[model samples]
Target chain A: MEIKETFGLMARHTDDVIVVCALGMSANEWWQVTGSEDTFYMHGAMGFASSFALGLAVAMPDKQVWIIDGDGSLCMNLGTLLTASGQGPANLKHFVLNNGVYQTVGGVPMTGASRSSYTAIAAGAGVERCYTADSMNALSAVLADIKKPGHCFIDLQVERDDGPILAPPQPFEGPEMKYRFGRAMERRFGIEVFGPEGY
Target chain B: MSNPTVHDQLVAALKRCDVGLAASLPDDWITPTLQRLDREPGIAHIRVAREAEAVAAASGAFFAGARSVAVMGATGLFTCLGELATLNLRHQIPLFMLVSERGSRDDHRIYQEVQGRRIKPVLESLDFPYFRITSTADIEELPHAYEWCRMQKRPVIGFLARKLLKG
Candidate 1:
């Protein structure tokens, strides 16, 4: 399936889930598909988005959290799968956009992409609900299961689109992004993300 | 204070700061404290495979309106400098880390020498603020340090001195 099509399918499945996007292609494409202020688009931290999403899931046990990760990012921190599995937060869902290359850095081929099985790796890491979808219909078929409880992993094999990238990122700086995300959380969940003095 | 007392005091201070979650990768110096955190009923302790995972996890917990901390050794902290710069620094997320202050005169570990000699200078170059905790009295300041980290909107390192941990 095409990367855009994969994102479209995932976007349609997003209900009230808060998304965390890895830097580069995942963040850019997610912004294109969903102009969401609720999502935390990582501009840095190449491989730790999954860990960040895991933390959020643990903190808000009642809320569902999804991380849109890339293969390069996943390879950078494969231990995250182990950590996620060990913690096993029931509200967390991990999805990897595997295109066999680093889509953001001018399509450089990623290591072990062709031969590696991310689902098998996640399964070995103790994530029991592991799925792989290579086509739009396959992805659509697994949408319902994605929303189900328990720590889950999905490897979406997509064809890298050489087309022009759409959706410019939010213009806000780092601190502004923090406040925006925190405020959105407070507004949505009626929780105090910041103190009374607004630290 | 004895070694166990210091651990008790540190954990109590974390509780006083309202830290509900802790993410950690163990080092010998901080192992006692991590054990204490693991046993604390009110705090959820997450054992991670890498130090950067702990850092990122604690950063994410902040957005969920949760106060959290990351614990690691000095060498582990060195391994996570890139993630610290990109994730915590780039995002202006406040992450409170309790790191074992290794490579001091009392610490004879040769592998830790580079971390001891270079960690502070690197943190200085990155503009990250840190404080050294040396004794039981210093444990009381953790809550204040935690508040300062949030106000600063950056990662703050609280270095637990070898002397204190050895108690």
Candidate 2:
């Protein structure tokens, strides 16, 4: 499946789920598809979007959290799989866009991309429900199961392209992004993400 | 305050700061504190495989309106510079980290010497602010430090010295 198609499927499935996107292609494509202020588009922190999503899931046990990760980012901090499994937040879903290349960096091949099985690796790391979807039909078939309550992992095997399809960046950056996301959380969940004085 | 143990005092301090969640990786000096956190009733303790996971996890908790902390040794802190810079610094996420002062003169471990000597200079280069806690009295400042971290909107380190942890 193409990368955009995978994102399109995900966008359709996103029903009040707070998304955290890994930096680069995953974040860019997610922004293009959703244009969501509620989602966090990571500007840096190449490998830990999964960890960040894990934190959010653990904090808000009632809310569903999803991480849109990339092959290169996942390889950079594979230990995140173990941590996520250990926490085992029932509200978290980890999704990897596996194109076998760093599309944002001009399509450099990722390390061990062809041979590495992220689903198997996640299963080994103690994630009980792991799936791989290489085509749109396969992905569509698993969409309901992916949204279920549990620590789940999905490897979306997308076709690699030479360059990242340019998309508009997140409208906010740095502290502005923090405030917007935090405020959105507060409004959605009626939680106090910031103090009375707005720190 | 009546606990007399450093671990208990630190844990109590964290509670005073309203920290509901803690993400931690073990360092010998901080192990006692981590153990206490694990057993604490109100705090959600998460044990992570890497220091960066702890850092990023704590950052994530912040957006959920949950006050959180990350605990690790000095060397572990060194391993997470990229995450600290990109995740915490780049996003201006306030993360509170309790790191053991591993390379101090009293620590005496040769392996930790580099972390002791270089960590501060690197933090300086990154323009990250840190505070050193050396005595029981200093534990009281934790709440203030945590609030300051939120106000600053960046990762802040509270360095726990060997002398303090050993007390």
**Between which residue pairs do clashes occur in model 2?**
none
Model 1 per-residue lDDT tens digits across residues A97-163: 8888877666778777777799999999999699999877888877887777888899988887554
Looking at model 2, residue A171 earns an lDDT score of: 70
> Considering only chain A, what is the TM-score of each predicted structure?
0.94, 0.95
- Each candidate structure's TM-score, on Cα atoms with residue i matched to residue i, is 0.96, 0.96
Superposed on all Cα atoms, the candidates' RMSDs to the truth, in angstroms, are 1.8, 1.6
Worst ten-residue run, lDDT, model 2 chain A? A163-172
Q: Summarize candidate 1's per-residue lDDT along B72-117 as a digit string, tens digits.
A: 9999999999999988888789899999999978899899898999
Candidate 2: lDDT over CA atoms? 0.89
Query: How much DockQ does model 1 earn?
Result: 0.84
